[model samples]
Target: MARRIKVLQLHPDYNIKAHDFADLGEQIFRALPPARFETVNAFLRGRPTGDQPESRAERSIYFEFSDAQLKGMRIRAMWQLFRYCRSQRFDVVICNRFKPVNMMLMLNRWLKIPLCIGIAHGFGEYDRAYRRQQTARLVSPAWRFVGVSPAVRQYLLDCRCGFTERNTVAITNAIDIVQAEGLQLSRDEARSQLGLEPHVRLVGALGRLVPVKGHIHLIRAFAQIAGAHPDAQLAIIGAGREHDRLLREVELLGLQGRVHLLGFRENALRYVRAFDIWAMPSLAEGLGLALLEGMSGRLPVIASDVPAMLPLIQGAGGIAVAPADVEGLSRALDEYLSLSDEQLQMKGEQSYRYLTERHDIEVFRQQYLELIDSALSEVTL
Candidate 1:
């Protein structure tokens, strides 16, 4: 039998746990049949802390580089990685995000790896002129580009960076629905755990407390309808620098008791069932995995009109408002609040159906398998 095709999955950090956002590395590794592929995972920055889970690759390596070391020229890091790659004779390298992709581009010119695939998560990754120039100059026939969403793939094609239709494609992000559902708490249990009354009409969001998440806008929109629906409450999960600022916005709107910022709940997806409605007012997103998590919980959804989110909202029959448009968001929230229990449940079922149809994890895994097989075939030819 021929030797198994050696594969390396490179990541900038180890922050993404096994259950998060389809667990790309784990999915890709599992997609390749074990008898045909020998898979390894590498982290350029962080190491696992405490009970932090890792990718399910056959082997794992961590560089443990400092922030400063990963910056500037990254010559030292490149030398070490080159030696490692050379020693292993990897047949394929899959780099996540810009930093790993950028480094691999330069190193591969010398290593001459038969297949190098770079995955871009969102727009603006190549916004810098230098990064664009470097990518355009170093890209070769051996390389392939994957954007996490169709819009992001188009963004790559328009960047003037050597990514072409032939070399670039989209593989929309997905979540492990079965795993997420199994981990979720029941509605009443989730509500009680979140310190919410079981009977309250809850609007929920899961994301970092960052400006791009548009939590401020969501807060303002909820404030617009707060008085009308006194029984309704808004809860945002996750933590970030915008914590204090968002709190101030809540106070300014005098929505202290009605609006909550539950900073960074671990396995926060477990609490998704507590929400009567799910809102994603993001200004930008690769594919809004959190929105999928909420849909997996069978919650009625509403999101901004941003390209990344619009398709999901429309597919699920959820409302779509202009990003940062408080009036529009408030109106959408009001409509959901006005719906009777049966109507809300129907909307939620629609959302869940759309998720399974369009963003199923099995489809995602199959696509990756096909893409990899096709890429490997080209290498042999």
Candidate 2:
């Protein structure tokens, strides 16, 4: 009997909830042919405090670390990962983000893992020179780099990190439409659940409340036209360090009741139906996964005009405003508000159609499996 290909997916974070990396891991594990492959997940940090979601992977291992240990995390994590990798003897090591790629490369140098694959999820992951240099060191024929978007792939190439066309490929991110559809709530139901008024038009955004997410700009934009559209409300979901700052901003803008800060919802996408339109004003994004989820929920999108977002929103029943341009976002919101209910519904339908036709999760899964297969087939033990 043939042995199943043992694969280890290395993630930098301990928690596996809400984040895109967790979603990607789940999709890959669920889609892979179980008979031909066996998968395990190894996270570098200790388990998070929140309720852990049930994982689809065969097994999961966490390297529990203390706060003091995290101060010099790279060295500690590398030592722990080295011990783990030596014991597991995985045939393929898939590293998410640059740090994990570096860790895997360091291990590969000693262990010579048959196949090592790195995934670039966003622009910020490789923004630093140290990360680029580390990536350059991992550019052997046995290593393959997967970028979550073409923009990211191009960025890798432009960095001159020894990533050639043969070693790097772009695969757009995807959402689990089946699970998302199941979680869908009726507009009225969702609004009621969130304590929102039935008559109000809600503009929704979902992401970590971090600076790069540009929630501040979105708030500023909402403030610009809040008086003109008294029936409109802005709902920002997810929690981060910017939570208190954003609350202060909302109060300062005198948008106390109008802007709702719904923090870190486990099933945030379930409330998408409550939104009249989806707004993503991120300053930088690999690809707007929230925008995709909104589109899947049949909501028209309004996002920043960054390269990562443009490909998803342009000509896809959505509008793009320049990043940090409060006036532009205000105008876009006002225009969307002005549309008739029928027009808005038509736009929503178009978004759903576009998402279904192009960004289906099955397509993403198949592409990923193909990449994995290519890597395995090309490299010999």
Query: How well is each residue in 136-234 modelled by candidate 1, as lDDT tens digits?
Result: 999999999999888889999999889999999999988889998999999999988989888889999999988899999999999999999999999
Compared with the true structure, what per-residue lDDT tens digits does model 2 show for residues 1-381? Answer: 899999999887875765343288778776689999888988776665656664567988878765566454567767787888889888888888876787777678887888888898887666688867876886677788888889989888788877888889998888877778888799999998888889888999999999999999999999999999999999988999999999999999999999999887767877889999999999999888888889988989999989877988985769999999999999999999989889999999999999888888899999989998888887775
State each model's CA lDDT, in order: 0.90, 0.85
Poorest stretch of ten by lDDT in candidate 2:
13-22
Lowest lDDT block of 10, candidate 1: 15-24
Best by lDDT: 1
Cα-based lDDT at residue 74, candidate 1: 81
- Where is model 1 more than 4 Å wrong at Cα? 16-21
